[model samples]
Each structure stands twice: as structure tokens, then as C-alpha cells.
Target: MLASILMTVRKRRQPIIRLALSTMVAALLLGALACSPPEPVRIGFLGGLSGRVADLGIGGRNGAMLAVEMRNRQGGINGRPIELIAEDDRQDVEVAKQAAGRLLAQKPEVVIGPMTSAMALAILPQFNTAGVPLISPTVTTNALTGLDDQFFRVVAPTAAHVSKSAEYHFRENGLRRPVLVCDLRNKAYSESWAGDFRTAFERLGGEIIAEVGFESGQSLAALASSVLAEQPDGVVIIANSVDTALLVQQLRMRAADLRIATSEWAATERLLELGGRAVEGLVVAQYVDRGSTSPAYLAFLRAYRERFAHEPGFPGLTGFDATNVALDALAARSRGQTLKQALLTQASFAGAQSPIRFDAGGDTRRDTFLSVIRDGKFESLQ
Candidate 1:
């Protein structure tokens, strides 16, 4: 009976010993974790990787990649590496929403795109609810101006920048009368661009002789004929590169010598390829001056060309600028500050083209340039 009582006592003591040992292990693990370096910061990049406007999305993604890779090569932010999580929204609203849901689950502190204004609008509300900061590289919808949300952009608003283009056409280009052409499919961008340009040009004593609309995959011959009938001094084509190419080709067939200009919306490689000789001598407004020789821009350009075998254009340049802005915010976060507050309070960022500054409404202000297509390449006239 004494032996049995000793056995019970030992069993109870064994439980107590195990508890003590487990507590010690837990404490040791916590100490080691505290002593180790922090994990890499997560950044999400969402853009269209497939579908019609994939070139712009690809360019933006490439730019973001360059920024992240360069930062990593230079020791990253405060010794913590950065891991970029890229997603393709396919430029569809529902797809963008789904992609955003998945990305938010990854808990990225910041996100880099939704390159088009439409995609940005689609996913911004969800990101706002999650309190994640989203900086777009090329979203320029007029409706997004002054929006009280976490959405910020590197490109200027459509109304503001397009108005400047109007002034350029009237004052510098010496075009008194012009016809406006818009793509109805991308009404959000094309309509706003045409409307803003019309309002500004008319205010500057220029006349809009005609307004024409067309849809992609439809014959633009009738629309082109109607526009040429007006015999305007110049034609303003506000559409994506493919649609712009079709319209310009049709117009060129009628009057080869007619002056033509394009909104920044259609400024892409696809334009040069599809429009061919028709796009030659076309004046276009651009957010980035590709001819900039600034050291910072030159470094970026060289790296970009080396990696992609192509020159960086507006989408790439703006994407690089936007990602750098996010990196700055991340750096601030590592120092016990909030990302949103840091972005709002930080000073201007000198970018590839000009100094970029954000207003209280998160709109970006920068200089624009007028470029002419010479030999199927953009040559900055500014």
C-alpha cells in the first residue's frame, strides 16, 4: 500500500515538471523571435495582364518589378527585404474585385496598380475598407479627382491634363478648328477626354467642327467620311491605340495631308504598329517626356531596356514613380509611422519626368509634353 501511494505521487509530480519545461521553451522561442530581424514587407501589384489593353498593364508591372528589384539589390528598406505579389485583373471589374479579395488576404501593406481608371474605381472601395493604400500609375479619370479615399495616382487627372492639351492645340499648334472623335466602348475615358478638351478649346477661341463616335470591331469608314466632310483644321482622336489606329487609317485614306492629333489615351506602341504611316506627324500629349536625360531617368531607362528589350514609355515611367512612392511609405512604416500619414505629409518626389506632388485629395500634379510621331517613334517637342 505504501508503494502504490508513492507511484501516485510521482505521476502527479511528472505533470507539474512537464508544464514548467514547456513554459521555458515558449519563453526561449519568444526571445529568439524578438532578437531576429523582421520579415520582408509585402507589396501587391494588380493590373491587366491579358485582354485588349494588356500592353499598358504589362509595362506598369515591369516598372514596379524594376523598382522592387532595385530596392532589394540596394539592401532593401532598413534591411528587411520586399516581396512583391503581382496579380492580373484582366481589366475586368469582377475579375479585379476577386483578385483584390485574394490580395487583401495576403495582407500587403500597399498595392501598386489597377492601371486603368475603370479598374481602379472597381477595386478601390474594397481596399479602402481594408485600409490599404493603393497608388495607381496611369489612372486618369476625371471622376476620381478629389475623391476622399486611399487611392492615389502618379498621373494627372484627365480633365486637368487634357485641358492643358487643349491649350497646347490652340495656342501652340495653331489649330483653330478641329473635329473630336471618341470611342464609346471606353466612354469613361474617351468621353471625358473629348468633353474636357472641347470645353477648354472652346474657351480658348477654338471651334469643334464635328464630334464622331465609334465602337471597336465596327467599320469606321462612315464615321471617317462624315468627319472629313467637315474639313476641319485638325482631328482629335480620343480612343485606345487599336481604335485610334483604325480611325486614323480611315481618315488618312481620304486626306493624306490632314493634320491629326491624339489624346494621351491612345499613346502606345500598338498605335505606331497599327497606324503605320498614318500616325506619322501626329501630335500627341504625353505624361512622360521620353527624351529626358536626367541621371535618375537615364538609369531607369537603361535598366528597363536591358531587361525588356524595349524603351520605357509613360506607363513604365509612371509605374516606376508610383512604386517608389510606395517604398517611401513602407520605409516610414518601418520607423513606427503610418503609411497614409507619411504619404500625405511627405515632400515632393523627384521622378523620372518632373517633380511629383500630391494634393490633399490625392491628385498628382506634373508637367505634360507634346510629342510628335516621326518615323513611327515619339519625339518630344517640349
Candidate 2:
């Protein structure tokens, strides 16, 4: 009788034991679910971060990074943090292709840059194949403009910037004859910019005396001499900041009073640092208005200075704006909505310095300002 009773008791405890085991498993799973972190939204950045154009790349990268950091602090997109992956294209076509391949492998929601027009053209095909959109901070070549492809830029096209500078040179600056020094390294941008400037300036009765083309490593002294051979009243330089600064220095050594201007591509903090007095009167168009008292711009300037310990310049400002546009679209996109579709759905986005609006072809325009380097600063040309 006692053995039977014991057996009955054991049978009753079986269900309890099973129930306890199931409960423990449920508790462990819940604990794990609570402890695990959420997935991050991946974003990619591509630029020539280690070459002659590194200043622009580094500035752009830092700006994107700062935007991601700030957004993550504010609870991120739908509670998921953002992860920015950066690649240096080294300003080489092969390197840019490899970098794009590496960035695409990670499956980013969007990419923020190629910095220059050449890099954009180099890696655009790969990004299109992967169905990823490239939101460039500074690639303004007309070749990419009005394309319904996977490319979009925050700044206007080459014509928008160069034409304005051309008009300013012809009508306002009273430069009747000018020579162009084109950098062949960035052939796409330099050529497009020079072509537009030529059209605009010539239409305005200004003459281009000569066009001197050179690669980056060529002798700036010889190039300067060639430019001086034309005996032009003014000079326009289309090159990177480093080369532009060196060429300006070379020209200054020969003709102290020659009026000089450069493409906005060469307008960076490095130009002032390297060119010093030579770039003092150098005129160029800028995407940002430095004299603005806008709260958004002031906040960005302060944050950028604090984060990077320096000025953000054009690249940084555009980088920040481009990344924010991506993030806004990412946050607002509905289920099953493509990133391109999401971007186009919005009427406009608020930029750090100004409002940004895109056309149906994913082309946007910013207010370009004509500024001259004065007292080691970019001052508005009144």
C-alpha cells in the first residue's frame, strides 16, 4: 500500500516538474532578449581620405560622423543606433572601385560621399548595381546632374557655381581678360567647370586669353610662367586646395598684383593655411553663408568645432546636410518603401545653413555666395 502511494505521488509531481522546466526556459529567453542590443542602421562614407584631397574627405567624414553621433544620442532611428563605415578611395579609380565594393558588401542603407566628381563617376555603377543611393556632399559635375539614377547631391551642379563666379568676374569684378589653370587630375569637374565659365564669361564680353592644363605633380612654377606668358588681367584656377595654394604662391612670386580666383573645389581651410597672403584676394563661390545668424547654422558650427577642433568648411557643412537627409528619409520611410522613393517623397529638408529642396531627378540647389579670402577668413564680397 505504501509503494502504491509513493508511485501515485511521483506521477502527480511529473506535471509540476515539466511546468517548472518550461517556466525556467521562458525566463532565460526573456533575460537574453532584454540583454541583447538592437541592430544598427548602417551608413557608408567614401572619400579620398589619405591623398592630396584628404582635407575635403576628412572634413566630410567627420561631418557625417557627427550627424550619426548626434542622432544616436537622440534615441537613433526607431531605437536602432547608426553605424557609419568609411572608406578611403585615395582619389584613384581602382581604389575607388575597391572601396565601393567593400562598402557595398556591408549593405548600407545609403552612402554619403565620393567628395569629388571623378570618384563619383568611378564608383557610381557599383552602387547602382547594388541598389544603394549615393548622396554626395560635394560632387557637382554636370555629368551626374539630372540623372534619375542612384546618385544625388546636396550642392548644385558645376554650372550653378561656375557660372555665377563667371558673371561676378565679368560684370562686378571688371576682369576683362582672364586665363584658366585647369587640373587634369579631376578632369570631369575641371573641364565642366571651365566650360561653363567660358560660356558665361564669353557671353558677358570677357575674354579667356589662355587655358593651361596640368597634372598635380607637374611644375607649378612652369605653369605659372605659362600663365604669365599670356599677360592676362586675371587668373582662374580649377584644382584641389593644395595644388591651388601652391600655384597661387607660384603666381604671386612672379606677379604680385595679379588678380586671382579659384573654383569652389579649392576653397577650403587648407587653402588659407597654405596660400596665406597669396590667397588673400582670391575669390570663389561658397555653398555656405558664413555671416548667417541662423540658429541651426550656429549650432552646427559650434558642434562641428567642438567635435573636430576646427572649422567644417564646405565639405563638412554639405556632409552634415547630406547625412541628415538620409537619416530623415530612413526614419520616415514606410515598410516596403525604397530609400530612393522615401527621399523623393519629401518636399524638402532643412539644412544646417539653408533649406534644401530636390528636383524630380534628384538634383538640388543651394544658395551660392561669392566670397573672397580676407584677413585669413572668407569674407562676403559686397
Candidate 3:
């Protein structure tokens, strides 16, 4: 009888011991987790990941992703891992606002991109209301410049690029009578660039014979005919790569020997792939120097190709530079200082090919290069 009683007591105690062990294990795990590290620092990315302009948006997103990946590989900002949340704006105003709203809801420290000026304008109000700064890689419309708002960009305004191209055409290329073609789809960028070019070109004693504006889905043949009818010596196209390439082909079909120049908005590799022989001899200005041999740029180029399996174009280079600017400010910010304040406080930040300095209004300027397509490649005119 005593043995039976003792056996029952042992079995009960066995279960209690097992329960204690399980509780202790769970407690130890919780303790370890608590002692590990803080939560990740969240960063939001917005761009047109789909649709016609996906090339620019994807490149910018990839560059931002690369920056985040590289930083996380090393000990992230102050030992906190960075979590990049990317959203596709779809290159539509409504979609961009929705994407921005979603990103803002996540409460990221900062958001990088909406690669074009139109998209930036669409979502700037949301970012401003959320108190999160929007740092763009390639939005160059002059509309956002000199604003004390939350918009900041790594590239200069439209005037910086188009004004230089105008001077180059007038003085270097000797194209006195030039016609302008604008893409109405991205009116913010296209119109801004065209207006600036007109101002500069006219100021240099060059005459603009005609100015034509059309949307992307319009007939290129009719557009080309309209542009050619002006009988101008030179033509400047302000559009995206796909549109630019198609229009160039149309123009080449009619005027093979006419001089053609394009704004930097169309200066992507897609333009070459799509334009082919038609794009040869087409002049353009770009913020990124493809022939750069700087150590920082070369290293970034290698890493980007290895990770993305493609070349990082102007969008990628500028996106990487923009992200680094935000990261630098985040790392150096005082306990209560805002990201904008932190950025403005710094004198300069390191860029892939050059140094980046932001003015009091969060605007930055970089070197622009004039290049012409030679044998299907952009060769610098410098």
C-alpha cells in the first residue's frame, strides 16, 4: 500500500518538475530576446515599379535597396538593422498618393523616391502632413526647389540641366534654329525643362522656331511631321526613354541628317535598346558619368552589378547617393533633431563620384555631362 502511494506521489512530482523546466526555458528565451538588440529602423521607398516609366523607378528602388543591404551587412546605423519597405506608385497620380499614404502609415524615419517630378508633386503633401521628409533621387522639376517643405532631392533643378544643354547646342553645336517637343504626360518635368531651355537658348541669341506638346499615347508620325514642318536645323525632345526613342525613330525616318538633342529624362539604357540606329548621334545631358573611374563609383558599380545583375544608371547612382545622405543624417542626428535639421547641419556628404552639398532649402547640385550616342553608346563630349 505504501509503495503504491509513493509511486503516485513520484508521478505527480515528475509532472510538476517538467512544467517548471518548460516555464524556465520559456523565461530564458524571453530574457535572451530582450537582451539581444532593438527593433529595426524602418525606411520607406516609393516609385513607379510598373508601367511605362518602370525603368527609372526600378533603378532608383534598386539603388536604395543596395544602399540598405550594404549598410545592414556592416553593423547598421548604430547597431540597428534597417528595414526598407518599398511601394509601387504605378506612375499614376492616384496610385502614387495611395502608395505614399501606405508608406506614411508605416511610420518610417524617411521615405526615398517617386523618381519623377510629377509623382513627387502628387505625394509631397502626404509626406509633409506626416512629418516625414521625402528625398528624391531624380525628380528635377523646378517646382519643388527653394521650398521649406519636406521635399529634398539629390539632383539639381530642371534649369541646371536644360540650361547647360541649351548653351552647348547654341555655342558648341551651332544650332541656331531649334524646335522643341514636350511630353505632356509628365508635364511638370517636360514643361519645366522646356521652359528653362527656351529661356537659356533665346538668351544666347538662338531662335526656337517651333514648340510641340503631345502625350505619350499619341501618334509619333504625326508628331514628327509637325516638328519637321518647322524646317528647323535642330530639335530637342523632352520625354521618357520609350517615348523619346519612338519619336526619334519617327524623326529619323523623315530627317536623317537633322541634329537632335534630348533632355536627361530620356537618358537611360532603355533609350539605346529601343532607339537603336535612330538614337545614334543623339545628344543628351546626364547627371551620372558612365565613364567614371572614381574608386567609390567603381566599387558601387561592381557591387550593384553583382547584386542586381545590371548596370546602375543615373537613377541608381543618384538613388544610392540620396539614401546615403539620409543614412548619414540619421546616424549623426542628435536625440531630438529632425532629419532635415540633421541634413542641413552637415556641410557635405560623400557621393559615389563626387561630394554632395545641400543648400539651405534641401536642394543639391551635381555635375552634368554632355554626351552623344556613338556606335550605340553614350560618349562624353568633355
Residue 382 of model 3 has an lDDT of 86
Q: Could you give candidate 3's per-residue lDDT for residues 214-317 as a string of tens digits?
A: 98779999999999999999899998899999999999999999999999888888899999999999998898999999999999999999999987889899
Task: Pull out the clashing pairs in model 2.
Answer: none
lDDT of each: 0.86, 0.92, 0.91
Clashes of each: 0, 0, 0
Where does candidate 3 have its weakest 10-residue lDDT segment?
Answer: 155-164
Cα error of candidate 1 at position 333, Å: 3.1
Cα lDDT of model 2 overall? 0.92
Q: Of 1 and 3, which scores higher on lDDT?
A: 3
Off-target runs (Cα >4 Å) in candidate 2 are 1-23
Name the TM-score of candidate 3.
0.92
Q: Tens digit of lDDT per residue, candidate 1, span 1-382? A: 9999999999999999999999999999999999997899899999988766777888899999999999999989889899999999986789899999999999998999988877887899998999998999988888788977889998888777787789888988899989998876566677778888989999999999888887756778888998888989889998777778888899989989888899887787878888898889999888787777789889899999998888668888888999999997777654666687778888787677677788888888866788999998999888
Instruction: TM-score for candidate 1, please give it.
Output: 0.88
- The prediction achieving the highest lDDT against the true structure is 2
Candidate 2 per-residue lDDT, tens place, 1-382, comes to 9999999999999999999999999999999999998989999999989868999999999999999999999999999999999999988999999999999999999999999999899999998899999999998899998888999899999877677898889888889999999988889999999999999999989899888899987999999999999999999999999999999999999999999998889888999999988888889777788888999999999999999899999999999999999999999999999999999999989899887888887889887888999899999885
